[model samples]
Each structure stands twice: as structure tokens, then as C-alpha cells.
Target: MRAYTALINPISGGGRAAERWEPIARLLREAGAAVTVCPTRSREHAVALASSAARRGEIVVAVGGDGLVRDAACGVVAGNGTLGIVPAGRGNDLARTLGLPDGDRELARLLLDATARAIDVLEVGGVVVPGNVYAGIDSMATAVINRNRWLPGALLYRLAPIRAVLTWRPATYTITADGRTRELRGQTVVVANSGSYGHGLRIVPTARLDDGMLDVLVVREGRLHRIASFLRAAKTGAHLDLPEVEVSTAREVALAADRPIPLCADGDEIGTLPATIRVLPASLRVLAPTAPRQSR
Candidate 1:
């Protein structure tokens, strides 16, 4: 029997993680796996718990959203353990990227098999981000989502951008990718490892977790009236066709702005501008399907 430790964020998905994990835990136990449940009090606590369990040669399962998954990955990397994920958060972006199953029975079966796949991760200012790191208006929208936790997940993610755009100001952004620099006046810049975020938006359609490169997207400053259309286009990755959008791939990226602009990764605010992000190739071993479903 495999030893597994589940680090669950009690309040994730509007306090639905624990409720969602119950059936999965029961299934694992029925499969004869030794499953240990740990309810995380905070992000720091989740990391610590994951590290300790991983050091014991146990599979560390993150049972929450992308934020919790990032924390668990940090600890698992430190302890050199394999990772498992259960999608019980508002934005299961990483789970979506890995093509993890939504149903409890399917997820439990996948967990029991313990199939591991190596994937790339983003290292930004000493933090591990499994999805994408973004700045400008998207970061502001993340701030708005964080403040209004009472709203439903999809509703909050959809409305936050509109709320953020009301006060957003364009910034002169300097982006250096693999030492090649470019300057642009933009409202959003995204360095993506996973193609999808904001519940299911295909922010960068060409990004892949094992690609060993970062997909850098710059949304050039445009008329405020175009924001809604751009967002709608982003859902199907059609925004890349817009003249204001630019996409490229690089191994490392440095971002700086004329003024302070907040940066957000894996659904949490990391820091401000002048940040350096690099891809750690094949750094994470995750229990995922043999073939990951790509975002359109």
C-alpha cells in the first residue's frame, strides 16, 4: 500500500475542500492505501506539513486550489517527493492544466495508480508557481477577487476584471526575455507555464507544462471599450489575433515597469514589478493522466 498525505485547505473553494475530500479519502482507504489527512491552517502550515510528509517518502497530495498546490509543490520539491492534486478550489487552474479528473471516483483511481509525470515550474522571487505569473490589470483583478471572497468563484473571476479596469492605469513595461528586451505600453503582462487560468480562460493557448519554456504575453494598452471584447476573445484564445496582443517564448523573463505594478502567481499576490522569472525544467513530479488535455 502506498503512503499518502493529503494537505487540505479548509477554506478553499468557499470552505468546500474538507467536504469534497471526504469521499476521496474514503475511496483511497478502500483501495488499501494508508491515507493521512492534514487540514492546513495557513499557506505556511501547508508547506511545512507537506515537507514533513514528503520527507517520509509519502506522496504529498494537495487538496485545494492552485494556491495550495503551489505551496505543496514547494515542500515536495524541498523533500523530493511526488505530488498528487485534488481539485477542490475556486480556481483549479493547475488541476485543469494536468487534466485531473473532477469526479471523486475517477480522481481516487488516478491517485491510487500513482502515475508520475515531470513538469516545469516557475521560480519567481523564491516562490514556486505552477500556473502563471501575471502583472498589471490581471494582478489588480486578482486583488479584487481576494477582497471579495464571498462571491461565487466564476462570478468573482469574471467581474473582478471589470472592477479592476475602472481604476487601472497603463504602465510603460520593459520586458526582457532570454536577454532580448522590448518596451511596450501595456495594461497586462503574463508569463505562463499553464495555458489556462481564471477558472478556465485560455490565457496562453500555446503554453505547455513540459515545454521547458515560458510563454510571455503582453497585452498592449488599448481602448477601455475593447477590454470586454479582449476578455471574450481570451476565453477561446482568439485574443492572440488582436493587434494589441504579443506572444513569445523564452527560458527566462525579467519584468520592470515605470511605476510599481503588483505581480500575482497561482492566484496569490507575490510582489511588484522588477521581477525575474525562470522556468525550472522538469522540476516537479505530479500524479497526472498519461496525456494532459490541452486548453483551447
Candidate 2:
């Protein structure tokens, strides 16, 4: 029988993955799974390990945050294997979208017993993003969040974007979505697969994982206070109703800007933009909850 391989990031969850591994392993084994725990040395290493394990017909479980999950997804996509998640990472936003249980024991049980469902992922500039693709001020906030993994919980989530807003500036962004091209001076252009990011902020409130289409959000440049107000509105997904924000849906989106703008995928900086993102419908097979919590 093909065993389950757990690809764990040691630094994930502020280094909590190492502390949580033993019990997670024990639980899986007790549940009659042939578990092979793989501690990843680096992001690239995790992808390599997951890809290898999946090639052997084993289910690959990502035991960390969105970054590790993104890496594991790449491996699973490449090898055509099923993916599972044990949300030990800080944000666990994707886990939240999947309606994953808060408790680790329940999470482990779900991983071991759950059946696979196909989900859509974004193909952004050669990267496989299982969640959302964002740029501008939002990406800046994500950069801050990525740098301060030690902050933990509320402080990290609340403060990072606050800091990002202080240094925010708009750029001339040219965007083409579903063949509709437009240009604007904006703060962000987001293509969401799962919607929420930066610790549950609904950047694109209506985005769904299985929608077979991507939700694109645009926030044009505004006064500092207005921008701050927009950020606050985003928490309750009220930003979508703001006049400064525009929302659209498409199967593909291409973005470019006059200056080099930072880009992020699944809450980690992938690279700067001038890229095309397309939806791959029902391409990823993973263990997902039947009912996902709606972010609004």
C-alpha cells in the first residue's frame, strides 16, 4: 500500500512544526496509516521531497503554513498525486477557506480519512498559486508578514498591513482580464482563488476555490486616509462596495506596471510582475472540507 508522506517545514508556525510533529505522526500511525514524515530543510527541499513522495503514489501532506502548502502543491501538481494539509502555519488562511478544523487531532483525522476533491489553482508567471495572486500595497503587506513570522497571531496579522499602508504608493498598472484591457493608477490588482489572505482579510470577498474562474480586485490610488479607510473596510469585505475599488471575474488576467511592483502568491512574495495568470480548472486534487466558511 502507498503510505502517506508528511512534508514538514521546521520553521513554519514560528518553529512549532518540529514541536508538533511527534504527536501528529503518532496520531496518523494510530489511525492505521503508513506515515513517512519528511522534515524539509528549505522551501525548495520540501517541494523536491513532496514531488518524490507523490511519484511513489503516496499522499503528500503539507504540515505548515501557506508557503509550505504552496510548495507541496507544486510537487503534487507535478507528480499528479493527492495533497493534504495539517495547518501548523501561522496564518493557515487556506486552511480556513477549506473549513479545516481548528484542532490538530481533527485535522490529522481529516487528512487520513478524507477523500480528495479537485480545486482550481492560479498559474502566475510560472508559479503554481493555490490561493490568490496580489500586487502593490497588499503585496507589500504580505512582504512584511513574511518577514515577521515570529510575531504570531493577532499582532502579526493586524500590524503588518498597518505598517504597509504607511509606506504605500500607487503605480500605473495596465491590466487585461478575460480580454478586457484597462489601465489605472492603483494600489493593487488581485486575482483570488480562495479570496482571503493576510490572516483572513477578505481581499476579494466573493472568490471561491471551485468557481472555475478567478476574481480580480482593483484598488485605485486614493488619499492616505481613504486608503486606510479602505483597508479597514476590507476586514469586513465592505471595501468591495467602495467606489475606489473595482471587482471583476475572469479565467485569465495579465498585469503590468510602469515601475517594478512586488508580487505575492498565497501570501509569499513570488516575484515582481508583468505576468499572466490563468485558471486551471479542477487541476488540483486535495482533501477539502465539504462546507467551507464564507469570508464576508
lDDT (CA) per prediction = 0.90, 0.84
Badly placed stretches (over 4 Å) of model 2 are 292-296
RMSD of each: 1.6, 2.1
Pairs clashing within candidate 1: none
**Tens digit of lDDT per residue, candidate 1, span 1-296?**
78899999988988989899999999999989999999998878988998899899999999999999999998998788899999899989889878788899999999888579999999998888888999999999999999999999989888999999999999999999999998989989999999688989999989999878899998898865677777798898899988888889999999999999999998999899899999999898999997645543
TM-score of each candidate structure, all chains considered together: 0.97, 0.94
lDDT of 2 by residue, 174-256 (tens): 99988899899988889999988877777788888987999989888875466557668888988878777888889999999
Estimate the TM-score for candidate 1: 0.97
lDDT score for residue 191 of model 2: 91
Supply candidate 1's per-residue lDDT for 286. Answer: 94
- Model 1 scores worst on lDDT over the 10 consecutive residues at 287-296
Judged by whole-model lDDT over C-alpha atoms, candidate 1 comes out at 0.90
